[model samples]
Target: MAVVKISERGSFRKEYIRWWKHPEKDIQLFDWLDENERERKTLFSPGYLRDRRNPLPYGLTKMECGLRAAAALFAGDPQRGQDYAANPRRFSMSVHDHIRSLRFKYRRFNSKIGAKVSNMAYVDIQGPLLQKIDQLMLVECPEWIRLHFHWRTDPYYNQYWPKDQPTAREKPVQANAPERQLRKSSPGLVNQKRALQASAVRVRDGQNKANSPVMELPTPRENSNSGTTQVRSSSTTQEIETLASEGGHASVIHGGATNLDGSITSIQRLELLIQLRKLDIEREDKKYAAELQRAQVEAANRHQSEKHEIMKQLADYVTGGKGSTGGSSTGRDE
Candidate 1:
C-alpha cells in the first residue's frame, strides 16, 4: 500500500525484485505487488489524477505524456530523469518507439500467449479471471536497449540525438568551442572585489593607528648633580632599549631589521605595508577581470556561431518542423 513517487520508481523496482526473490517473503510480496498493481492501473487508466508538479512541456500533448509514463513503467529498468530533463524531445521519441513495439506485440501474440497459461488458476463468477497474471506480467517486461535497431531504418533518425555521447557533427563544434570558465562569473568577480576592498580598508585602519601619537612624561630627576646625571643616563639607556625592541618587532613586518641609523619610522613602515597590500588587491582585480572577459567571449562564441545553428536544427527536427520531410520510420522489427 506504499505510495511510490515518480523519482522512486527505480528504487521500488529494486526492492520489489529483491523481496520477490526470497521464498520466505512470498505472502508479503504478493500483497505488496497487488497494491502496486491496483495503483499503477488506476494511475494509467482513463481519468487519472493530473500532477501539476511534473507537468508536460509546452509542445507535448497529454496523450504523449501519458504514453511516456506508460513506457517508463513498462521499461522495467531505471530511466534517468536527467536524460529527459536535458532533452525532452529526444526522450519522448524514444518512448514512442518503445510503446509502438509493445503495442505491436500485444496485438500480434500476447493474447494467445496469455490464453495458453490461463488454465493454471481457479475462476469464480464474481472474482478475477482464471489466469497466471503475475507470470504474464513478467513475460511482457521491457528491455533497456534494442541491440539490432539501427538509425538508418528509422524515418526520424535525424531527430534522434544521443545524450551520453556527442555526434560527429557535434564533435567539431565542441572542439572549436572554447572551454567554459565556471569560476569566472560576474558574482565571483564582485565577491573578490568586495573582499579585496575590505582587506585594503583594514590595512588603512592599521596604518592610522600606527601613526597615532603616544604621550610620554620626563623621568623624575634627583636634586643633586651626580644623582641627576645618573638618572639622565639611566633614562637614555631605557629609551634606547624601548626603541630597539619596537624596531625588532617592526623588522618582522617590514621583511628586514630596522637600520641602526633609524632611517625608517614606524609610520613610514606602516605606509609601506599599506602600499604593498594595495598592489596585491590591484593584481587580483586584474586577474579576475581577465578571467571574466574570457568567459564572456566564450559564451558569445558558443551561442552565436555554427554550434547554435546545429542545435536549432536538431530542435526543429525533433519537434516536426513545417514542410519537413523527416518523420518516424514505417518499418517494423523482424
Candidate 2:
C-alpha cells in the first residue's frame, strides 16, 4: 500500500476571523485587542464599529475583517487604526512606542533575542510604512511625490530610491599620451642629469689627487744629463744608509719619512743594504777555509801518537818479557 503524506493548511483567514470575533484566543491577542479597542474609542468613538445602536446586526465582510486585523498587527495595537486615520503623527508615535516596548523586553534577556529585537522592531513599523508609501506612489502620485519628497532625507528611504545622480567628487582625468612623453623630456629632468654628472666629475678628481705620486728632490741625472735615471746625491745616500742600518725596526720611521725627499732616500738605502748582505755571505765562506785546515792537521798528529804507543806494547808482549806480562820495565844496557 502506497501511503500519501499530507500537511494541514494553516488558514490566515480563519485565524483573522477568530481573532476578530473573539479577540481573546491568545493572551497576546487578548491584550492587544483590549489595548486596540481602548485606543480606537479614545481616537474615534464607541459607535465607530456599529451601524445602529437598536436592532441591525453589526456586519463585516471577510475582506474587511482581514484588513482590520492586518492594520492592527502592523500598528501593533488595533486602536492605532483610528489614530492613523485621525492623524499620521499619532500612528508614527504609536509605532515608536511599540518599538520601544519590544526593545525593552528583548534587552532584558542575554540571549538570541537581543540580536533579533532591533531588526524585528525596525521591520514591524518600517515594513508596513514602506509598503504603504510604495502603493501610494504607484497608484496615487508618482511624479509629484518624487519631486517634493527628498526620499534620501531618510537613510532607510534612500536605499530604495533610483540611483541616477552622480556623486560630488568625480575621478581625475588621465594624462593624454603626448603629455606623458613631454613630461619625461622636460627641462627639469635634463638639469638633474647634468647636476649629477658634475658632482661625479668632482668626486673622481678628488680621488685621483689622493692617489697621485708626490714630487721629490732632484738626483745626479737631474743635475747632469737632466733626462737619464736620477742618482741620489751623496748626502741623501748617506742619510738612506743610516736609516737602513737601523733595520726597519722603528714604528715611527714612516711618520718621520713622509716627506717626498726622505721617502726616496730611505727606499734607495734599503735596496743597497740588501745587495751588501749577499756579498758579505760570499766573503765569510772564503775567510773561514784556512782555520778549518789547521784544525784538521792537529787532529791527524794526535791520532799518530796513539797508534805508536799501541805498537810498542804489542812488541813487548811478543818478546815474552816481564813488560808483556804487565810488570814495570827499567832501561837496560845494549
Candidate 3:
C-alpha cells in the first residue's frame, strides 16, 4: 500500500465521505453493495455449499474484510474502523486455515503496523485505501465483476499485492481444470433437454395409441338397396374423417385388424379416392377423343358428298340436258 502524508489524510477522508454521501454516487458502488448483500445471504442460507460447511463463519475472508473496511471508511463508522484495526488478523483470515484444520481453528496473527503504534498512525492506512477506492470509482465497471470475481483474478486490485500472494476467498486452480470454473448449468442446454423430454413423451403416447385396438366399421355393398348403401357409406365416411382428424398414419392404421369393410384406414381411403379421381379423368379423356374422331369423320363425308353433287350439276349443264334426258323431248312445249 502507498503511504500518504499526514496533511493529505484529512482531505482524502473528506473526499471519501463526500463520495459515499453523494445522492447520485457511482453505479459500481451500488452494484458492489447488491453483490455483497447476495453473498451474505448465500453464505448464511440453510443450503448445501461446496466450499463452506458452517453457516456462521469463524472469521472473515480478505475480500470480505476489504469490503467491510471500505464500507466502514465511507460511512464514517469510527467504532468499526477501530475494531478492525485492533484485530486485523481476525478479519484477514486464511481460507486454507479452516480447510487444513479438521477442528476448524481460527488463529490470529499480529498486525503488520505493530500494536505499539498510536491509534491515529494505525488508522492512517485508510488514506491510501480511500484514494484507491475513489480512483476505482471513476473507471468504467466491467461486466465480468460479480459474486465470483475475487481479488486474485482482478488485475487492478492485485497490482499492490505480491505475485505469489494467495487470496483467502479464492480456491487454487487445479492443473487439469479449465481456466474458468462453471458453478451453474447453461440455460440453453437446460431448455433443449426439456424440449427433448417433451417430444419423447408425445412420441410414446402416439405409439401407445397405435398399438390399441380400433372399432369395427360397417361394410359397403354393390347391391341395388340404396338405403343400406347410403347408411354404410355415411358410417364409413364419418369413421375415416375422425381417423384423419386424429392424424393417424398408414403404419398406425395397418396395425389394426382388417374387418368386413376391408379394415380400410383413413390413409387408405384417401389413397383410394386419389386412384378413383385418376380413373375418372382417364375416362373423360377417352370420351373426348372418341367424340372428336366422330366429328372429323362426319366432316370428311359431308365434304365428299358436296363435291360429288357439284360435279354432277356441271356435267348435266355441259351436255345441255334436262335432268338426265336429251333436250329434244321438250321441243314441242318450246
Per-candidate TM-scores read: 0.19, 0.16, 0.22
Off by over 4 Å in 3: 1-262, 321-334
lDDT of 1 at 129: 20
Q: Model 2, which residues run further than 4 Å from truth?
A: 1-268, 287-291, 319-334
Tens digits of per-residue lDDT for model 1 on 1-334?
A: 1111133555442111121122112222222323443332222222212442343324334445533553353334233344444444444343334334433443332233222221111111011121122122322321101110111112122122334454332232221111111111112223334543555566567754333221111122345688875675466445434433333121112212233475432222222333334455557768989999999999999878878899889988877763343332323321
> Tell me, what's the RMSD of every candidate?
39.6, 52.2, 38.2
| Positional deviation of residue 321's Cα in model 3 after best superposition, in angstroms | 6.5
**Residue-level lDDT tens digits of model 3 in 221-328:** 347688885675466445434433443322111112222465432222222322333344556768989999999999999999999999999987877656445556
What C-alpha lDDT, on a 0 to 100 scale, does residue 103 get in candidate 3? 15
What digit string (tens of lDDT, one per residue) describes model 2 on residues 203-235? 457755333221121111224563331232333
| Stretches of candidate 1 exceeding 4 Å from the true structure | 1-79, 111-137, 140-334
Candidate 1: lDDT over CA atoms? Answer: 0.33
Look at candidate 1 and give me any clashing residue pairs: 155-329
